[model samples]
Target: MSKVMKGLLLVLAIALIAVPASANLVATSFGFPVIVQSGTTSAFNQDTAFASDFETLDIDFPVFGDGFELGATAGVVAADGVALTGTANVLPFGPVNLAFPSISQTVEQTQEVTHTDFAQTNEQAEFAYPFVGVGPVALPGFGFGW
Candidate 1:
């Protein structure tokens, strides 16, 4: 082979062997240290009882920014409660799944919450929708969404 070709092959051989050795597969889990704690919301109420037999799951992540999120919640949360009728993006927590309103129409719902109950003000874990212009006052319902 030519002198240049032989030199090129030798360089290639050294690079192939050295690359993997020097460049160890480096994978580091990067996340801000966050203290895990159960979040709660104060009592909230609605005019009429809208959500019953609801499945509210709160999902908290390890990161947050101005009106944004970086990753999914630390884990799947399975909590249930009643809240107002609106988008799910208004809740105080990170990401929440309110599996109510019967996504599947096949399931038969025998009972509905009556106006007498009206979903009285109650404390729910990680689910609350505060009324605008009200200071720290949350109205009853599984609200907050994106």
Candidate 2:
């Protein structure tokens, strides 16, 4: 592995161990995509597998005002293929060796998440507003008169 990949892996490990449970989490994923097969014209027979590592940090906290909330999240993922070992059979060659190529990738991302809602209270009297004319008779109001 290169220096950058090693450093990233180290950082991910440390973040997973040091961060709090509510803030950070680390996950490992494995997949068996290829299955061994024995048939005509098939040269290699092996069980292929893929593995990846991921780290996530998420926070949901209060904002500057009521009914307004804010959130933020950051994550990193690294994927690479694992080693494959099995037997190989060919038509002409009979039994032969098999080795499959693999690749690796690392991704890091951050996002801002937030939610805000403007809601009215149950008190209908708070919106009541009425105006009176200069004369003794009161003018008809257009606001909530309840």
Candidate 3:
């Protein structure tokens, strides 16, 4: 048609030829929490004790004849205790994306353990003997020995 119109058409054709065409549209977004926690807690305690005691006595007397007396005593005690504990192990993950259509994954884990033990023992022993007289005659007395 006119000179101005021809020049405009030629410039428009050149611009179209220079630009490259895109067939696919892609968009990406990412967000994560600022805090991440991971830790372990443990504790242990123990207690123990021991004790023992012993006593003994012996006596002899003559009352219008012959008499005898004796006594003995013993004791023992013991105790033991133990304890163990684990609070927890915490692990947390914000988010993970593997591929195409925005796949998200979250993971968390926690664990705890506790244990206790106790033991005790006690023992005791005692012995005694009585005196006897028959018509001014003394009789032998018997008692536990060892």
Candidate of highest lDDT: 1
The C-alpha lDDT values of all candidates are 0.43, 0.42, 0.41
Tell me model 3's lDDT, rounded to 2 decimals: 0.41
Lowest lDDT 10-residue stretch of candidate 3: 68-77
Q: TM-scores, in order shown?
A: 0.18, 0.20, 0.17
69-106: candidate 1 lDDT, tens digit per residue: 54332233344764434322222344654232212233
Model 2 Cα displacement at 140 (Å)?
Answer: 36
Inter-residue clash pairs, candidate 2? none
Clashes of each: 12, 0, 0
After superposition, the stretches of candidate 2 with alpha carbons farther than 4 Å from their true spots are 1-94, 122-146
RMSD of each: 43.1, 52.4, 54.9
Candidate 2 TM-score over all chains jointly:
0.20
